[model samples]
Target: MREPVDARRTRILAVVHARGAVKVSALASELEVSMVTLRRDVEELARTGMLRRGHGVVRPMGDTGPTTVPAARGDEPVGEGAAVGLVVPERHSYLYETLHGARTALEEAGARITLHIAPQMAGAERPQVERALAAGVHGLLIAPRWRSAAGEEADYGWLAEVGVPTVMMERRPRPGSVLHAMDTVCSDHWYGIHLAVDHLISLGHRRLVLAARNDSPTARSIRAAFAEIAAARPEVEEWSVVLSSPNAGPGEPGTLEEAPDLTAHLRERGVTGAVLHGDEDALMLVQRLTENGIGVPRDCSVVAYDDVVAALASTSLTAVAPPRAEIGRAAAELLLYRLGRPTGTTGPVRRTELLPRLEVRGSTRALLRPAD
Candidate 1:
């Protein structure tokens, strides 16, 4: 036996009016329904002027004073606006492109976006988030800095406590942890690594090497996918080179010198194909190889991870281009959907992963045919 949708929602409104402001967790427990279900109901009621949602609590509409409630159902109408907060880690090139896409989508939906720029240090995002909340944002889109492997838990638990709908851009929950229950949209780095490996295998490359930056969050996924592929294809000999530090800033030379002689290492391992994590590392390796009289795609083929600096290289490199703008647009759309409905109930958590496109260029070619 089950209560009707309207009946359940009516009960929810009754509880809100009775309690003044009720915590979401408490309301969900009282209704004997999951938090997801309760959230959907609350969202719908808020849209129709029946209730108002604040950080972590629901209250009866107009209880505090006279107020104007935005219509819950309608297409994008001018002057009907909601404020959304966006937080990102600095103005990096990729992040800028992602922000552009988010802005475009928000504009199309008749929403206002407030930008918050935070540094890449841990705990630096909390103040920015507080500022957004104080500014009366209805929802949030955030890209948190990477946490160390040993960090006790996800640092964004405050998001759930605050009770506003949130979407994480380009971030995933730590492995084996369900601590944060928020929607997410990110590029599929694992799939991109698979594409890189498959492309190399198709080019008669049996001896392969993966040059990765150990500092990147996506490094784990890339390594896992590469190992899985290598294990399945036992004939391919694969090795890895992890850069100790991320690439140095512009005009900083001798960074590669600090690293081991990668050229000698690759030749010693008999690796004929290499998948480099960034264009900087790939180009640096290629320069060293050329100086050692090794010809790229003649004796060795190289594929880079990010397409940001791929074409700028002296020898254009084949690269995996993550759908940066697409990720932003998809994230913004998901947040808008959450705000528009609030209490919309679905079975599974909402997560969208966009695939990266392999941009083939002059850097990769088939091995020369062996003499019959």
Candidate 2:
């Protein structure tokens, strides 16, 4: 006698109900079927609003409404029918402005957003997306941890498999990964770096230094772009690039002091111009150089990436302004589009990249001529 598939599914679900929760892998093992097959069943159940899938477990729908709560201390209302999850690395003071800007944009369109703490999605993210999934939000916006592109693919795949549409903010999937098939919203990193480097070079700075995190795809891209442009200039006598080590702990004082130390390492090599990957790092370098008695733009010039106020506050940081607020809005738009809740409309798979703009501020100056 052939057992009916629906009957088997009913029985499987009944067992799940009896247990209150069950892992998908375990269900597949029990049914002697592939995980893919089991996942399809779960998807059907999810589509029908019967259950919600998590990382390793499934929960019954059981009359619980979508997990939308009143505005908490750090959050504001995003409005109706549009529920999105924000998976950020960590909560910093600056994030509030970015999130608020996004909230304002989405609220105007009547979208509601719930912020979740998902630090794993940062540089070395954890497979901890289950809690956000159980909430059964309409969409997800991930600011995934910066790591190998392969890791990025795995994380996105995990989210997609759970039937929630996802968009990555600031990070893109590795090219050729199945997850890369999805859309992303990223800054025009290469062009931004080009402008930053060119601006410093034009200030009579013959030597240039590019500081970046080693092996970072975004950082690597920026470095390669700068290198290409620098290679074309003959007047620039020397240039040096180095990936800063995290080992330079916060406690390390005066590491940049003197011409024979870090600065000297660069000076000995005749490297004067400097471009930094992020404002945070740029400020760090500027402080180090100042501690070493080197004057910015005179002894060295520094440009920051991501024109956050923290970067601009420093007198020596001329920085490229990344559209952080705009990126957040774009990410929200992607999530809404996926949920069939576009701003004043809806659409199919959508993706976009915004160009970054260089803001010349007080930190840069033309090198002074030698005293006659």
Candidate 3:
């Protein structure tokens, strides 16, 4: 009953070849389909070098083969200057550093990089990705948005249908689910949690709390790792405080108006150490605790997960720094490797996991107790 994907794509190419140049709307009307579906087919065809795309029209690739608009120029063959698309959620410091690393690697490989920013919403990335594919990118590096736990099983069937080699950046399918069969480069978040917990326990912290955003994927990983480690050490007391509200503003997740009184909560739970999932949250918590006359590193030791703001904070934070640049470089290398290989010749799915390093600063110290 449903039309086959290849069949639809074939029809699109036929139409494009016949007309030389066809507007997306006209094609949709001719095929009796919605513009979204038509555009998807066109994008796929363009990605495979079967067609080229302009503003809103599709054209058959010239006899010279697939046309690519390079981001930069260099003394290399046209194929060596192939363009690669990178789609990320936002242009934050961590992501920017990652992009820089990717750019460095791509340049070395004589490839050009094009960037697209996808909004942090469900299904919003599809359009941006389609646009990149239509622009004739040789490959793609993407950090897809997984908006909710219910949508964790989202698949990349569309990506495969497009026939472009893609490498996921710092993201992966949920555990126990079938792997997405794509290359991936991500930080070892579970090990980062271990480093934080081990450091706290070694510093005489028996009672610990993990402060995190409940809806964040990274937070979920940290929480799971904390639970596993806590279960193994029954003598230690561990708890988690989840921030249920959305981020207050750009780069500010813990400054919500409805933020709970962490001082009172920590006092009641007898938490002597805390591992916050974000630098913003940890910095805010430290300020709040200081305002309440609690001395940091004296009354409580804090470790932030993301190191973005660790050194910037008034009291430099002991934090886990993810290998941001390395992730980018690795992702670029994987994508370029895929591009160099023949279609379907990539023997095995590649997955690279870089470890996060813990940086000790003034915010945390060995907890000293009065004479027993």
lDDT of 3 at 215: 46
What global local distance difference test value does model 2 have?
0.63
- For 51-103, candidate 3 gives per-residue lDDT tens digits of 88854557888734334333322322222456899987763556777888888
In candidate 3, which residue pairs clash? none
lDDT of 1 by residue, 1-372 (tens): 888999999999999889777766567768899666887888899999899986446889867832333434443211225788998877456667788888888875557789999876656678899999999887898876553433224464665566667888877776445534668898899889888888988998888877765443555566677777767776686666555224421112322313456677678888788888766667887888899977887888889987878888888999999888888999998887677553544235687899999999888888675671
Tell me each candidate's RMSD, in Å, in order.
Answer: 10.7, 15.5, 14.6
Of 2 and 3, the candidate ahead on lDDT is 3
Model 1 poorest 10 in a row by lDDT: 248-257
RMSD score of candidate 1 (Å)? 10.7
What is candidate 2's lDDT per residue for 265-330, written digit by digit as tens?
666776667787555666777778888888776677778776665344548478887677887777
Name the better of 1 and 3 by lDDT.
3
C-alpha lDDT of candidate 1 relative to the true structure: 0.73
Off by over 4 Å in 2: 1-80, 91-98, 120-128, 148-150, 153-156, 215-217, 232-237, 245-261, 310-316, 341-348
Best by lDDT: 3
Q: After superposition, how far is residue 67 of candidate 2 from its true place, in Å?
A: 18
Candidate 1 residue spans exceeding 4 A from truth: 1-80, 151-156, 244-259, 342-348, 369-372
Tell me the TM-score of model 2.
0.66
